[model samples]
Target: MIIRVRDQFDAYSTNTNKVLEAGIDLKTRLFSEGGDSPYANIIAVNSKRVNDPAIVALVKALKTDKTKKFIKEKYKGAVIPAK
Candidate 1:
């Protein structure tokens, strides 16, 4: 029961099916077990203006200790927020 990346956020948190791991997560496991990674996993944003207070606030929030703890606790490492 593999789900696509586009549907994971909804399907993963709510759907009855148990999500074993994401493809990237599997690759991370393999990489740790001495196999090459299939590819890199990452997140990015392309905001037109980086100076907006909302945007600044978001970036700031994302880097904070509270936010990092919240993400780790809430997502349980399924969503790895970059440090």
Candidate 2:
């Protein structure tokens, strides 16, 4: 799966557009068949904050919950996707 975060911009509209662009770009790069597993699911997240530590923590928490739900619904045999 993928996670994307936005950066602050001069305007909220422009920032949102940039966030979408960045998310698409990241998804393409990370999921490209020549790059990584093409079957892997992609997840996009937007955040204006620019702190790596905070982002990491947030991602960890989100992954924990999301994984549980995903396993329960989608893949009952696996707790999480193999990275």
Highest lDDT: give the candidate number. Answer: 1
lDDT of candidate 2 at residue 59, scale 0 to 100: 60
Angstrom error of the Cα, residue 46, model 1: value is 6.2
Q: Which segments of model 1 are wrong by more than 4 Å?
A: 1-48
RMSD of 2: 13.0
How much is 45 displaced in model 1, in angstroms?
6.1
TM-scores, each model vs. reference: 0.45, 0.24
lDDT of 2 by residue, 1-83 (tens): 12232233332222223434454433332222322445545445566554567777866765686766775576333223434
Clashes of each: 0, 0
How high is the CA lDDT of each candidate model? 0.50, 0.44
What local lDDT score does residue 26 receive in model 2, on the 0 to 100 scale? Answer: 33
Task: For candidate 1, report its TM-score.
Answer: 0.45
Q: Residue 56 in model 2: shift from native, Å?
A: 3.9
